[model samples]
Each structure stands twice: as C-alpha cells, then as structure tokens.
Target: MSEQELIYLLALQKVPNIGDISAKKLLRTLGSAEAIFKSTKKELKLIEGFGDLKINSIHDSSYMEEAEQELLFIEKENIKVRYFEDRNYPDYLKHCIDAPILLFQNGNIDLAHKKIISIVGTRKVTTHGVAFCEQLIEELAPLNPVIVSGFAYGVDICAHKAAMTHGLQTIGCLAHGLDQIYPKAHAKYESEVMDHGGFMTDFWSGSHFDRKNFLKRNRIIAGLSEATIVIESAEKGGSLVTADIANSYNREVFAVPGRNTDQLSKGCNNLIKTQQARLLTSVADLVYVLNWDIQDQKKQQTQLFVELSTEEQFVFDTLKKLGKSEVDVLALQCKLPTFKLNPILLALELKGVVRPLPGKQFEVI
Candidate 1:
C-alpha cells in the first residue's frame, strides 16, 4: 500500500462513526482511497450513508495531517501496522465485515491459529470468580489454546497472568493502542506478555481510550477468537457484549455458572438459560467444542512417562485407566494419600503424560 493510501485509511479510522464497513464501501465505490479524497462532495455523496457533513469531514485537510501524524507516532513506537488488505492481518478477523482497517500492534503475532478463546467478565468480580478464572485457565494450560482477552481488571487480568505463568501465547486486545496500555496497572503483565510471543491491540497510536471505544474493541476480541468465555457477569455486564459480538461473528460463546443467587451469576445463567451460551463446567467442555483433543497430539504416551518417582509413577499408571478421575477418587482407588498427590500431578502435567481438568481432576493423554 502507498503512503497516501495508508494515511487515507488512518484518516478514515479517525472519522467518527465512519467504521470499517462504511469505509470499505466508500473505498470500493471510488476505486481507491485517493479517489475518495480527490472527489467532489457531489461525487462522494453518490456513495451510501455519506451525508453532506461526512463528505465535508473527509475533505478536510486536517484529517490528512492527523492521519500522517498518527503514522509517524506509530513508527516512533515501533508498532507494526496491519492494513485490512494485508495478508498478515488476522485471517479469522478478515471474515468479519466490520473488522478494523488498520491495527497498531505490539509483540509477536500469528493471526492464523487453530484455537482462540477470549475470557471476559466483570471487572468487579467476586472471590469465587477469581478462583474459577485462575483454575480454569490452569486446567486449559496443557491444551495451549491461544488465549485472548481485554486485559481488564478482574477476569481478563487473571486469564492473562495464568496463561503467562504457564508460558502460553496470549493476546491483549485493547480499547486504546500500543502507544499506551489502559488502566496502566497492567504494564507489568503487558511487558511479560510481550516476552512470551503475545500481541497487543487494534487501535492506532493517537487513539484515546474513550468509553464507547470499548464497545468497538469487544468486536475484535470476539471476531479474532473461535470462542468467547464469560467467567462472571452481572445482570447487566461487559462479558454480555463480548458474547453478543461473538455470536454475531458466528463464534461459540460459553459462560461459567456461579451460585444460583449471586449477582454475578445472573448474566451467565441467563445466557445459558436463554441458549445464548453453552454452560462451560470444565476445560473439557471448551476443548471438546473446539475439537482440540490431544488424540492427534498423542505421538506416544510412553515418551512422556519417564523419570517418575515410585508414587508419581503409580498415580500416572492408575489415571491412564480411569479417564479423568479426581485426586480423591484416585487416592481411594490407589490406596494413597491424595495429599501426596500434588507434586506427582505437577510432574506428570509437566511431562505431558497427564492433563489437569477443573475441580482437581486429571486425565491421561
């Protein structure tokens, strides 16, 4: 793409309410972005949804300067720009008609991936919500799903940290851009995520974090991922918007149900009850839907079974038969202390012979 075309797309992004769909429509009608700039108001209005006011806004020279400056600042930040036409732009996202025209990104990104699941929930999450967020992703760690989230306070932060802790590649899709991180408290997590082949955002360098920008940002999170999971949400919630957007993109949506009467459970329960989302009780539920079974990844379970202590080896041998039995159940069956089971579980998980699941269960590969 040429410099003018690049800046023209940036200027189009700057044009309030002139989103991806409309911008592409105008670009298609005019043959090129430069033609849109050179055309008369009479010529531009021939396109749909271009009011006289929007036409004049596009003609303003200041829009060009703003776009140019935005590009320069992006260069300063060393943020790579992905145009909608770029083959490197997320292939999954490209299918969405409203996908952003340009993205200002930081960190390693391979937009084409087999599994992408976004974890979004209320920032004001309860204690149980926190535990589920951490444990569920920990269980999912073995599958190596490409975790995606908003990087918000409650569930998003937990999901990112958990993925990072397990050394997984996670993406933080921001309401703002690579020039700065929103909330600012997440700078540590963002820095660490970058180190682990993660990715940042869809906004440009100069884009400010306005409230409505989040509504638009949620679409990228939903569109990029194959599935979206709601950990906890109020009757009125942020994750609902992500769920709605994911459904709009024809992606799977799941929500973890909480205690029946908890305020945070309302949105999740309503979602499952109304058939808007599937009830996600375990990592298996997601892995099953995404078809990320380790059955193909199973080269030889024997290769993963070396160097285990007598007790650890015993637990491993037993789990292979039971198919995701709980630690207590394993202890009872093996006639051993489940208390001594933690280190053995970790060792087996590290070696890839056994996979952990929610509620302290383990499954053999």
Candidate 2:
C-alpha cells in the first residue's frame, strides 16, 4: 500500500488486454506489480496466457505516466484505495474472478461480517416497484442489512433512501469516478449517502464516460452482495445483466413477479420462468431462502402476536409435529401441493412461527 506499490498497481490496471484475471495471474506469479514491470519480456512470456500483445501493452510507458497522474488525484482528493489482496477489500467481491484489482472508496463504509444485498432495477421504475422496494427494506430493517445499488433513478435510489430511513448502511456503486456524479441531479443525496455508507468504484478520476461503464460496474454490484434483487426491469436492462453476473458468481438472485402484461415485469417473469431466479413475492421468501437469523427481540416479540391464516396454521402445526422436514416431505404430510405448501410455509415464516433450515427443511421457532 505504499505510494510506489499503488502506482505500479494503478499502472497494471491501466494496461490494455490485461484485465483483473490476467493481472492477478501476473501478480501472483511475479509477487508484485513492480516486479511484473521490472521483469524482461522473456520472463513475462513464461507465464501461460501472456501473449505478445499483452506483453507489449505492459511495457507501454504511457500507462505509468497515467498511473502517476491518477495517484496525484487520489492524494489530492484523499481517496482510499483498496488492493484486492488487502483485508479492507470487499469480502464477497474478492471471491469473484473478475473483481477489480483496485477499489477506490469514499466515506465511512464498513462491510465486515455484515449481511449485504444489492437492489437493482430499471431507471424508469414503476410506482409499484417503488412501494415494494421501500416496504422490503422497512421489513428487513430489524436485521440491519446493508443495501447496495447503482445510485441511479428509480429502484436504486429508492433502496438507498429506504435503508437510510431505517438507520441502515447503504452503498452506492457508481459507474463514474468519485470526482463526478452521473445524472448530476443526485448530487443532493451524495453527502447523506457518504454519511450513512459511501460511494465505491474501480474507475479513476477523469475517466471517460461510456455506456459500457454501466455494464462493467454491474459486476461490482452483483459481486459485493450475497444476493441481488431485481424489483423491476424491462425485457432488456442492466439489472438483468446484474442478475446474470450474480448467478455466475454462485450468489443468490431474487426477482419480483409481476402481471404477465406489465412491460417492466417481463424481465423478472422471464428470470423466474427460466428458473434463473427465485420468485420473490415478499421479504419472507428472501428471509427463508437465505435463512437469515431473526435475532431482534422486538421482532421476536411481535411475531408472537402474529395471526396466521388457516393454511399457515396447519402448515406450522404439521412442521412442529414432524420436526425439521424438507419442503417436499412437509407438502406430503400436509397433503398440500408443493406450490401451495411453499406459500403457506412462507406465510408461516413471515409470521415468525417457523424457520427454514438448510437443504429446504423447516422447523417451528
């Protein structure tokens, strides 16, 4: 993390054709970014996957100059830089193969031992989407999960605001550099976001604004969280791309279902129909699937007074009698179809009368 090491890392990051995977390979083989640059072409060629073009790009002097300039910006702005190998780097993101070699951060962001989830959707989020996003966060507030989003219009901002309203940390994963904010209008929320959580990005100051940047940034959104939730999206949108990336990372993905005719719901519906995402009707589905421990005393007390429907009560009583039983087994015992039993179990979970165990088993709380 010294100035020289950071400069070398920044230069390595700037090298063309050498992405996070390649850079990691070089760093692991050579032991340091400085060594990678200091080594001869013959030495570099010894590494598998290092071709002539990538080697030539590594030797380009301009990258070093650019790195130096970027370093100056970092110092001037007091930006915190996290090397991928450092403990301060995002834990979930570090597991991703293509995660950035460096992450630039602003504000009092903390991710240690925290339950993090990313909420993303279309920029033109519907009113229903807004209500669902807000209500979801409010219901989840007791568990104190961190909310992460793109900081754009609609669902992203709605998630951030709702998180803040509930006194929870929220992170905005920006497509641009910390030096500027896209959309410009969101400037008002920047300070509040910083105070509550902060802005995170791999891009440097003065980086060109490109449409492709949003796609690149989506990986960060999906990588940083254990789960990614798409509240609303069209047939083609960035949120769908994020869901794909999350699935690729072996992370959980959830999509809110909508009516068949709703344009914004098409993407989510497709995701569910294709079994690419879990069909999420309420926060209870998420809580059950992720098996998040509900340890809040107030929440526990409230659950005691919760009234369950006739079906939910039956399912709860069956689960208690059967002890921990898989969803399939519980369905048989309850004489309910799997589909019908799933919702009843979700309702029981929402009432806090039952808890989901690993391998789709459930037990009374």
Candidate 3:
C-alpha cells in the first residue's frame, strides 16, 4: 500500500470502539480507509452497527496524527505491515473474525503452506513441562512444522528454543509493539528469533503496555495455527484462554494430561474432562488426530525396511485380518489388554505397517 493509504489504515485502526469486525464492515462498505475518512458523518451512519459514538470516533482528527507518527516508526524500523486481506497475511488468522486488520511483523518469516502449531502454557512452567515441550518439538521437527508461541517466560521461550534447535521456523506473538520486548531479559534471544522466524504484533510503537493486552494477544497465537497445544497450565491462566480461542476458531486443541494432584495439571485436566480439548500424549496422537499425511520419501523408504516385534506383528496380523478394527476389538481378538495393545499399535504405526483411522480404529498400510 502507498504511504497515504497506510496512514489512513493506521488511523482507522486507532479509532476507539471500531474493532476488527467493525473496521472490516466499514472497509467493505466504503471500499477503503481513505474513503471512510473522507465520507461525511451521514454516510458513515448508514452502515449497519455504526452508532453516534463510533462515527464520532472515526471522525476524530487526532488519530490521523498518531497514525502519521506510527508510520514514521514503521519506515524507520523497516517493519513489514500485513493487511488482513493481503496474500502475505497469515492464512489461518485471516479466517478469524477479530483478527487484527493490520499486523506489524519483523524478520524473515514465511507461512505459506506450512504446518503451523502453537504451543502455550504457564509462565512458571515446571521442569517436567519444559522437558515435554522440548521433546514434543524435537519429535515433530521431522515434519518441519512452524512453531508459534507467545514470546513470554517459561514454555513460550522453551518452545522457541526447541524449534530453533531442530532447525524449524518459530514465531513469537507479542502483546506489545515490535519496538520493545516485554520481559527485558529476553532481549538476548530477540535477534536469534528474528533470524529464525520473527516477531509479530498488532500494537503500534509506543502503545501502552497493559496486562489486558496479553489476553487480547492470545487470540493471535491461537488464530495463526492449525492447532493449539497446552503443555502445562495452572487452573487459571492465559494458555487456557488461548486454547478456548483456538476452539472458538474451530481449530484443534490439545492438552497434555498430568497427575490429578499437580497444580499445573489442573487446567489441562479440566480441559480434558470438559471435552474442550483432545488428550495429547505424544506426536503420534497429534499426527493421528490431525490426519497429517506422512508421505515423505525418506520415511517411506525407512518404512519398507521396518522390522516389527512379535507383539507388534501379532497386533498387525490381527488388525489386518479384521480389515479395520477399533482398539478394543483388536485388543480382544489379539488376547491382549487395551493398555498392552496400544503400545503395540503405536509401534506398528511408526513402522508404517498400520495406519490409525478415526474412532481409534487401525488398518494395515
């Protein structure tokens, strides 16, 4: 967009009470931000849901000056602005009704046809949580999925680091503007993150740093990915909010189960109990639930040489004989308990001798 067009868009974004949904309505009706501002109050009032207060806010001249200043910051910092309708904007996020009309991004980030997943949890993540987060990313690295997370303490940073270690792209969704990092201590990782993926936010430079902004930011994290995973969260926290937002967006939500008594596990357990999220144990669960096609040539070649154990062979034979069978039926037919049969099935899946179907059924590949 041209400088003048960007100025008008930034001004429209600054108008109070005109959120993304409302702004989109105005843009669609008026055709452009410049036209919206140029139109008379009478013209603006005709749009559905436009009230006196909203019209007055849109006509406010002060936001134009603020937009001009923000424009200068964008130019000076070489930041990339992603209009909601632009092709470069995040595909998953564009479907969200409340997604930002403008997203300010920095670094060499790419989202085209990427397998993106957001991992979020409590800031005070436990050692076990950290280990699981790392292991999860490491295992998923082979798929080359983009790892997205809030650039906060604990699990967020851990996810970013793990993704980087695995040579996968990672994105940090910030609550504040790109001009500054929230936790100053994270300054050291900023350059590395920028190099690997980048930082993204809707807030302009010098925007007020409010705690409420974090909750609002959760939507972006949830919106940008095909799925959102909560490794660990307290009974109440922002990660659960992200999970809820993901669900609202009709995206998959996964929660790693924990011991009932553990404080961090309460939130995940509650999510599972309420059927708000799928119970996640390993990468296999995510792959199966998402039905990701693993057609890589290398994996295919390895599958050809895979050697299944006696238990796995028995399970595979039983499943093949039945053509397709749910976990319970196969367990009974194989004379193996469900618990014992599950691992064997997983092993067969990894060996590429079996594929998981919907409703926990499995069939030979």
lDDT of 3 by residue, 1-365 (tens): 78999999999999999999999999999999999999998998888899899999989999999999999999999999999988999999999999999999998899998899999999999999999899788668767899999989999999999999989999999999999997898899999999999999999887688989999999999999999999899899999999999999999999999999999999999999999999998787888799887666236535446776687777877788899998898888999877556656655665567877999898988
2 against 3, candidate with superior TM-score: 3
Query: TM-scores of the models, in the given order?
Result: 0.84, 0.84, 0.85
Q: So what's the TM-score on candidate 1?
A: 0.84
lDDT of 2 by residue, 59-99 (tens): 99999999999999999988999999999999999999999
Candidate 3: worst-modelled 10 consecutive residues by lDDT: 295-304
Each prediction's RMSD over C-alphas, in Å, is 4.8, 5.5, 4.5
lDDT of each: 0.80, 0.90, 0.90
- List candidate 3 stretches off by more than 4 Å: 297-365
- Any residue pairs clashing in model 3, and if so which? none
Clashing pairs in 2: none
